[model samples]
Target: NGVMNLSIKDIQGEMLIVSQFTLQAKTAKGNRPSYIKAAKPDISVPLYEAFCKSMETHLEKEVKTGVFGADMQVALINDGPVTIWMDSKEKDY
Candidate 1:
């Protein structure tokens, strides 16, 4: 049961997808983080919508999402403590 054999479509649970651009912040130069690597709103907005739509299509259900380009407060109680960070640019992450 611990095997990685499930996805959002296979799991019976609620899915909440939020657009977080700050995840691309670069802090190499100074104390203040730079968001230069993050995609611009013009490009990211449509991509975010398309991504959400794709998720809905795959899961066969409506997926909940936060408003784009809006200040949001998110609070979550993570039932599972496991965390995995993935980067597309780097291999074997």
Candidate 2:
């Protein structure tokens, strides 16, 4: 609940919440990435749904989401070359 919510609200933006477990991949070892830190489907599914619901509540609009634990393809045109990443575990940022 901060700038992200404000920016989206100001722009009347719609959000697509995708459950990308790969974001938690650990790559310090070999060529293959490890998803050991990612939560299992049984745990993540509920959390994902809850997150979408929370966002909808805060945004006062319907939020779209992808199917959890499913192999899906996403397509989006990059508005600009910039990308930002944030992690809940790294709250100091």
Q: Write the per-residue lDDT of candidate 1 for residues 19-40, one digit (tens) a residue.
A: 9988889999989999998999
Residue-by-residue lDDT tens digits, candidate 2, 15-47: 888889888899999889999989988898889
Cα error, candidate 1, residue 28 (Å): 0.8
**Per-candidate local distance difference test:** 0.86, 0.84
Highest lDDT model number: 1
Cα miss at 44, model 2 (Å)? Answer: 0.8
TM-scores, each model vs. reference: 0.85, 0.80
